[model samples]
Target: MTKQNTFLNDLRNEAITGVAYKNLMLKKQILEYFANISDATITDLSKGLNASIPKINELVVALIEDGLVKDSGKTEVGIGRRPSLYGLKSNSIFFVGVEVKKSHVNIGLSDFKKNLIKSVKRIPFQLTNSQASLDDLCIIIDDFIKSLALAENIAGIGVNLTGRINYKTGYSYSFFHFNEEPLSVIIKDKIGIRTYIENDSRAMAYGEFCSGIVDKEKNILFVNLDYGIGLGIMINGELYYGKSGFAGEFGHIQIFNNEIICHCGKKGCLETEASGSALLEAFKIRLQQGASSIITKDRPDFNDIQLEDIIQAANNDDTLAIELIAEIGEKLGRGIAALINLFNPELVILGGSLSATGDYLFLPVKSAINKYSLSLVNNDTELKMSKLGENAGIIGACLLVRERLLELK
Candidate 1:
């Protein structure tokens, strides 16, 4: 008997012994499939998963009986009896997504079918404000969940924050400043629901991969150009968190040698030149140097000018705003080109607030990539704007709960 033969025999024995386990896994798979898409017929599901129709039908029947799935009428394809469509009973289960920004928090409720139950509620609470405490944070979440009036139905809460989080351990290295206790455990104890935390970029990437416009492509980069830039790398259809879950800090990568210090304590980081914050900062610098723009043309004071105001001006083709955005895009493109060379991703997605700039951003970014990157690396790569828009983070947070928690149970 050889080692390979013994290993093969053990695998054969496990396969024979894992019938019940395999069925449970199959049921979960079917449920997840329904969760990701609108609805699917038994034939479609079987074909999609390449599994036996009888076995899938049997599990779906069990799922229907278990009140997890329901038949959603039928769809006629050609000229026959319509195949029955099934979907998850959305209201039967719920999840909460809390997206914490520096200045505000957006809380949302998602059904089992991954539909936002109501308009996302934005609470004006600052994570950086010293007046707010962990207790206050818990209360806000608890109150938000109570207001939704579906506290009992919620399986778990997912919080996506703009900081470094060891998502595996739920520890926050930036916000909350906790060392001994994971924030998830604290939130769970306070909110009376299972809680999970993730880096906002990672959560958005996961959501994009699972249900957003990315379509689960094997190799892709999701660059979130919000107040600051964050990168989400998906290699081989899985979110790459890297060692210590700090992989997506592309914003902090130093792209220039300058005296300007980033918030991350680095000088001349990509975010220092290309992020929403950096864009606004540059606009302010230009304003002080007596440069004029439609952004501050009607403003009470240049100090009151905002990033959105500049974005609006750019959308309307204000020369200064458009030029500034183009400049930022060029710098961002250089950084992205470096990433392309390293990762050789098939797709690079521009997401978050700055992505909304449309052509004002894309044209310059494309030009910079063409100039900076090797033709071989970027020729096949496609650049796209996120279809999920600002909802990416919230949707990702909601889905993360299901990805990390519900499936475990």
Candidate 2:
């Protein structure tokens, strides 16, 4: 009754007595409000939540005692005295973000205010289709938690992974299929914290949305131009999950006529020609065809050239790199034009590694959208790059841990 018995005493006790159970639901609502709005006065909370002023004030006092809320400062009220403003305590609770890639993992910690407080990038680990790999992944997360050396107030963890994922059930139909338990449960069992799994692209898009940099648009299409193309859709400020949570496979859209097989076991997918891998492939093919690039050099050391090298070369004014990237952008834009016609989204955000090319990529995409989609539709969809860039996945994973744990995701 000294600590946690204050805010989240026991819901099971509600069956026999109504001491603390009922307040848990109300506290959750207030916590969610603070998570979104940052700070509020008691009077503002009363009016916004449509509750009595006394009740709101009591909860605010309780939250402060629980170390979750604090008096941020005072706000002017145009009268003699200023009103006190309450906000979330930045370090009261924490969320961890884990992004898994084929070659490495990205891990980070975020404070209650969604600011990334710590992170380790590109940790060397191979993601393979084996139980050892998944076990190693769990060990990696355990080690990260041990290294925190902070108070044990972690509320949740969010894992960002690729391929078909059921964010709702935490079951990944793709990787880690070797486990009988859902992927989230497996990680949670190891870390002893509630865990949530999400599609990597969707996590990135959500990061952009929560960053408050998308002009607060209600409708958005986030095109992830990573090693493989992906899409994340936000309709009416909510992440859209189709029947089975396989909603945003924008890369697999059949827009070309070729014999190339996609990772998803389909042919002529958009990603086969417009993703980071596609760009790399195009660069190599062009080099073999005698096209000039500073990175390619005399022998076209294909294995030596990385996607980053290509992007840097383009920024350095390498003609061949720019040409290949622009070509891929045009094709990608052609596919995106069809999306604009259908969704009529207010904004389209380009994210992931390949988006780093800046205008070398966006200009051609803009031109293609103008030419392909109807003027009314294309004009409505504004284009921009994600402010978070490569950090989006890690940031989004951390934010989503709070959101989904609070049932907001």
Candidate 3:
């Protein structure tokens, strides 16, 4: 591959002479520094990379010529000549982030500077357990790239997939089980772009870490309360993928003794009682049992009453909706309290559509956490709703592409 298309290969290990290899390594280091801090001076680069000022300055000039960086501005100073600041060019390279939701697909484009340049959300795409679904997804992605005309400049495509995924190997144990080829490999081959597939929950967690209220936090747990419940485990400031790379299946924990079957074919899993799907089921059951809701006032069949409609009704003071959501929150909090006891994460950010209910879900969760968790352990865990909201997976996918490209995450 040519140096211009560094997306398909590691930028630091290109076939080059010794002098060029050294220069490439130095440039890679400089790019890392710029990624962490948007702008840096020559002295800052030299000190950070442990290189001389002249050498660092030389590479910075080359990077500018390559269109990877630009002069942001001069560092503000009152006493002496201000050093110029170099920053990653916002349009130099791009990453495409795709989130495969059960009901829709979310695509977002992020620049080298991590700004989401454009996005197309809520495209009607159903993720079923079939090869046809995978083909449809690839076709949509191809169309998206062609429409944007970013096939050549795009660095990578990150897909946030739900279910059992070996992120290290890009092999999915669930869904799109058509071939022996890893999902990432199949996608990369089809789309002609370097591709990565990550668990939706873990992707959301990493996204929250890089872009959320995380302020140098080292340990975190991102709880995805979507159609199904899932967990993203982070320890010591790194995403922890356990043996076989399928660690964060927090929903399959058998918490209750009911006969309800989970999506994983397990009985009485946490998701059976505490997830968005569970909430929907409970809402419908209550309506069938003579409970009333604002949505039911118009349509008694309750077939169209989705999770979002219930959340909206709760927001509008629908008594039945609020009660059902609070009950789910209480159950979810019980499960989370167990997680707190186990992981003791410093921060827990709630992500997914179900978390958008705000205080309706949060209050009950907090109450349950306080009631069930050890005082010291609960005190160590700070729970908050995701700032990125439903976009966490898409944004996280974009950021992960950059992180993997730079070998920084």
Candidate 4:
């Protein structure tokens, strides 16, 4: 090659590397500033990072170029000149969140701020336990992205499931036919973007944490009472995935020695007695006994009875339904008390479909915890309902993608 061409190529390479380094530094500063405070002025950020005014300006310009930060106009104080404020631009990018449940999958597209833009729900039957089924899921995901015109704009995909997950290696041991196949690799290979997998309950807990609630509590636990019970633990503001990433499998803990079997091939697990499926089973037995309950009146077709129907019956003063829920709540509380004694978390947020019953489930749960737990531990721990509701999984998934990308920087 000619001397001029070689020198020009070297200059171009140097420029690219310089831009990459500056971008990385700016991203780091933006994440650190946002983590420490909700908002910042360029002057404040400059002073905090010990960077010069011109350098700060350049960094902010680069951040804006990357769509990671934005200027929110000038803030006026009571007395002096107005100062410009900067904050993370939550809508600069988008993520896709997939929640894989035993019966169905919920796919949601969300912006960087974790706001759901669009969602699609598909039954498990549509996939039907085959290789082609996995392809179908990919098609559905692709369709959802195409619908939103986000095929090129998406940053990554997040998978939330009710099973053991290895975020580092991207393997899911608990759900699907290819138990050992890395879910992240499969999705990434098909979708052409990064993919992350996390336990559903833990994802919900992280969603709540990221939402800025429970800021005062560094140690918290989220109990999900769904098709089966699950636990999500956070300590010192970080999700605690124990060795093998199966730390919060609280549903499998044995609370009774009864002969009743659990899905995990165990007997008398906490979920066997306290989960929504268990409650539904109990409701069915009582209904068959000619129990006087409003649920029976509402859904004469026993096959159609749902968790909400029983909750509604209890709300309508159905003695059988109310008594049954209280019993399950007591059992759940006992399991919660065990958690309190073990971890001594500052707060326990009850989530999942059963939590929809509100105080109908919480009251008895509190009573059981108070009755069974040591006074010191009980006093420090507060039981509350999850603020995120069903959207928690999707939001948590988006947060996962954001967190991973930030870590890369």
Candidate 5:
């Protein structure tokens, strides 16, 4: 290396914390190594980074002093002395991750180790409230922080919104708005905590990949079929956020020229036919047509029917409920077939509340995929349900905050 660069590196090494490193790139590289691997030793880090043992040791010492990495006792080898194992200091700092849905918002907290320090708190609220929605969100978050006394330790808040979000710019174009100011700044001002926002689908994909669920899979598509359909794309083991940070709007894909109007103001979108709300609407229509079912026995008014009611009834072998789920699954598979042809992902993971229906939904989905997808693309893709489920967004948001913190100088 050049003398000036080397001198700068040496000078910066001793003058910065993990959260704000002078040799930021090197420090971030070391932290990323520990973040990806569990219980690594200094020897492992040196080998992993392809650097000298002495240099790696020096950086490790700096990290240890900064309270970022900690010693985890020792690892034993065959007939040899134990080597000290190091890992992230999981509790050194904390983050709050919030998932905003149409009907409610869910918040959770995690530490550096990605451990869920607090159970998620769900608050019922309407997103259409706009500025009032931000008010309600701040109130809940403020109460949560005060209740746990975590105001001092938290580094920032991450919000996963189920709307069009420009993650790089920290703006939710479709959800939260504050006089055109960035949502992150508005949130920080109101909640008294630095905040970042991402699209929910991207967050879920990130959470699953980083949280060790699909850690081994390089290319995958995470399908979240909740109230609406959302896709999280992982390509070559990295989350692919398109130039606009809005690539995963799989729900808005126009599939047919039907009269059904989508919330996106388009007609015959995938979400209108295959989402949780879609399933509920179809079930309500069936009930209105006098199709006999236990749901109708309890909720004679179709407006009273919920998605959970259909899932429960389907599990109990209710014919109407099972049929509705199967229909939605078939429609969902058509949309997914297009994704398979486009991305050719190795794994397609189905998540969200509707996915819990299991075989009742997946069977039809697979059938449709087989009928629609090219054999070459279909043969290599393995479809499975998301292991992360509801916690995917929350976990993803917390990890994102840690990633952002590591980028500081």
Candidate 6:
């Protein structure tokens, strides 16, 4: 090759390497700053990241070009020059989230900043024989994207399922039908967008982690108590999927000594005694036996009784309702105590529909933990309610897309 050509190629290679290194360093800084505060000024970001002013400026310009950050206009000051404030862009790109539960299906569209722009829910979307329902979910997602007028700008789609997921091959053993023929590939093909899937509980924990709730503490546990129980563990500030992606299947762990059958066909499982379904069953048995409870009197259809109803009944000081919730809470505490002993997490966050009962559930859980757990382990762990609320799954789904895109680039 000619010397001139070789020199030009070397220069190009150096430029490419320089850009890659700068982008990598800037990404680390941007993530750290975003985690520390929701937003920051370029000067503040430079100071926090310990980058030179020119380097920070170059990084900010590159991020803006990539549509990940935006200038929100200059901050007004009483003195000299106005400093520009840059923040993570909210809507330059979009992501789709599909939450699959036994009772319902929820689809949401969110921006880069994990803000829910639009959402839809379909209840009792049968999981047993539900191909049509799945197809409908695809249609709803397509419609939502079209509504946003950014169909081409969509980053990817993410689905959250309530079972063990194989992140490598995108297979789920718990939801076997969707395995091998992984939901990610299927949805990607059907919707003509990049797709990803994760276990629902893990996704919720990711949402909490990305939201700056669980910080560098690394080891944390998140328990979700809704129709059934779900658990998510984060180690080293990342989701810890054990061998076969079944690390956090806390619901099926046996809590009762008796041989009561669980949904997973296991006997004496935690879900059999402590989940919302378990509480509802207990309420029904009490009602049928002529036990006086406001739930039975107010809502005759036991099937119609929701966790919210139970919480409301408890709030109203319904004697039997309070007793039933407390019982479930106590059982849940026993199960959580076992987890605490085994995992010894720094934080344990209670989430899902049942968690909305707040202290009605927490008080009993605390009592049971005190009864069962060792004092040192119990003392170190902070048990708190999820701040993300019902939106955790959706936010996590969006983050999944962003995370994958970053990895790919």
**Pick by lDDT: which candidate is best?**
3
Candidate scoring better on TM-score of 4 and 6? 4
Q: Write the per-residue lDDT of candidate 2 for residues 1-409, one digit (tens) a residue.
A: 3367355333213353464555666676788788776588888888888888998888889889978889988996658788899888888878889999867888999987888999998788888778899888888888998899752677778898888999888899879978789988888877777789999989998899988358769899999887788898999988888999989999999999999998889999999998888998888888878887888563367766777789989999999999999999999999999999999999999988888899999999999999999997777788998898777898999888777665444
Model 6 Cα lDDT, one tens digit per residue, 354-400:
87778889999989988999888888888888887777887777777
If both were scored by TM-score, which would come out higher, candidate 1 or candidate 5?
A: 5
Cα-based lDDT for every prediction: 0.80, 0.84, 0.86, 0.78, 0.80, 0.76
| Displacement of the residue 41 alpha carbon in candidate 2, Å | 5.1
Model 5 bad stretches (over 4 Å): 1-27, 37-66, 72-86, 407-409
Q: Over the stretch 1-409, how does candidate 4's per-residue lDDT look in tens digits? A: 3123221122123255675655555656655676556678778888887877777777677667666678888876635788888887766667888877655677888775557787776445243445776787777677677788646557778888777788888887765447456878887788776788888998888888877356689899999888789998999988999888889999999889899999889898998898888999998988788877776666888888977678777777778877888899999999999999999999999997778778888999999999999989889998899887777777788777767754421
> How many residue pairs clash (N, CA or C atoms closer than 3 angstroms) in each of the candidate models, in the order given?
0, 0, 0, 0, 0, 0
Top-TM-score candidate index = 3
* Model 2 TM-score (2 dp): 0.88
**Taking the tens digit of each residue's C-alpha lDDT, what string does model 5 give over 1-409?**
3122232233224455663443456656777787765668888888887878887788777767666678888787645788899887777668898888777777889887788888554578677747787788788778878887856667778888887888788888887664678988788888877789988888888888877467578998999888899998988877788898888899999997788999899999998888888888888777778788987778877788878788889988999999989999999999999999998889888887787788998999999999999999889998887777778888888888777755421
Q: After the best TM-score superposition of candidate 1, give how far the Cα of residue 84 lies from its true spot, in angstroms.
A: 10
Instruction: Give me the runs in candidate 6 sitting further than 4 Å from their true place.
Output: 1-88, 118-124, 176-180, 212-216, 303-308
Predictions ranked by TM-score, top down? 3, 2, 5, 4, 1, 6
Instruction: Assess candidate 2 and give its lDDT.
Output: 0.84
Indicate the residue-level lDDT of 62 in model 5.
73
For model 3, the superposed segments whose C-alpha errors exceed 4 Å read 1-23, 41-47, 50-58, 72-85, 297-300
Scored by lDDT, model 3 comes in at: 0.86
All models, RMSD in angstroms: 8.8, 3.4, 3.1, 5.9, 6.0, 7.2
Tens digits of per-residue lDDT, candidate 1, 1-409, equal 3123221122223354466667766776787787665589998889887899999899888778656789988786757788898988867667888888765677788877678776454576757623255666788789888888757667788998886888889888878865467888888888878789989888888778776888647898999888899888888987898888888899998898888889989798988888999899888888889888876658859788877688888888788888999999999999999999999999998887788889899999999999999999899898888888778888889987877654621
* lDDT of each residue in 192-231, candidate 3, tens digit only: 8888899999999988888876887789999999889989
